[model samples]
Target: MRQPMIDTYEEAIEAVRACGILPLAPLIPDHPSLSGITLPERWHSDTELDPWRWRVRFPGDGIAAYGKFMKKKAILVASDLVPSVRSLLGSSRSIAQRYGDGLISKAAKEVYAIIEEEQGIETRALRAAAGMKAKESKKEFDQALAELQSGFDIVISGVRAPRNEAGEVNGWNSTCFETVEHWMEGAGIPLAPMSADEARSRLQARLGEHSSPQAMAYFAKVFGF
Candidate 1:
């Protein structure tokens, strides 16, 4: 079946608002996605209409969040629904609590501390600041980042290239990371505390209305609702 087409930012945002959650790729069942709805030529056009670029812009626009929050895939979640989503699948517990409780790894704690202190940072710089710069730490660093994103402790804010000492661009553009709370605050949204069960019920209700039974079942398992 043909997916509904979306060529511009406005149209895509409208579709996403209607659906609430959109995968960056074509992974979601019975739903529109950024890549799925967009034409292939538009992937990295280096223009305002690029879907690839939109992933970074969307979060800063204060309308939604862009992160690998579900199934370890990039997804854009509606701004208002984030608190609920985090409540259901993410930890509201502090890094200290989660680390102490053995819910997150030592590397995860080290990485998150830098993120919390800096408010946001690039992946390469974050690795350095967290003191995980050794070649062997690459895999563990990545896993820590993924773990934090999966737990909604952090999110990708945007894309940018770091600078060299001489003030020139250092390398290729990299994704920026920020605490979910900071991201929400920057967007003027609050990361309110809530009941996980309540969040699940609300999310299930919303998904049930907009998605199929089969999709709902799939989400229930994937997101652990």
Candidate 2:
């Protein structure tokens, strides 16, 4: 199916608000996606329409909340639905509590600890602090980061660029991770008393309205409702 149209950041924000949950890239074919709707060439352009850049900067822009919420892939949830998404996908248990439950891995615990100690640490710095800087540790490190993100224990608050000795940005941007509460500070996240079941039902209803049955089924399976 043809994707919806979004040519600028303003339009992207509106798309996310309208769709509620928008993947940064195509996951479920019929699910709403930034890449699906955007011009292909604009992806890495660092422009307003760049999906690549968007992943690095939800920017605390107040329109949508960004995270690796959908099967560990990046997604933008409408600001109003942030709490619902958190209820559905986030664990209320503390990181240690979750670790005791076997739902959180050792590496994941380590990663979360670092983010807790230093809010808004960039990916590379985070890995280093967690003792996962070696090339061989990349997979484990990435998995841990994804684990924290999926559980809503942490969020990508923004991005940082490597700076030269002269304090000039010298390299590609690195995404900054912070605890979900830390990220929500001063951002005015919506207030809604939603349970996981309620969030699930609401999401199902929303998808049902705009997505095909096949797409809806795939979404249910991929996101585990």
> Using lDDT as the measure, which candidate wins?
1
Backbone collision tally, model 2: 0
Show how many residue pairs clash in every candidate, following the order shown.
0, 0
Instruction: Report RMSD (Å) for each prediction in the order shown.
Output: 1.8, 2.4
lDDT of 1 by residue, 120-214 (tens): 68888899998888999899999998899898889899988879889999778988989998999899887678897888877777766677666
Error of 2 at 175 (Å): 1.2
TM-score of each: 0.93, 0.87
lDDT score, candidate 2: 0.77
Which pairs of residues clash in candidate 1, taking residues 3 or more apart in a chain or in different chains? none
CA lDDT of each candidate? 0.83, 0.77
Mark the 10 consecutive residues where model 1 has the least summed lDDT: 206-215
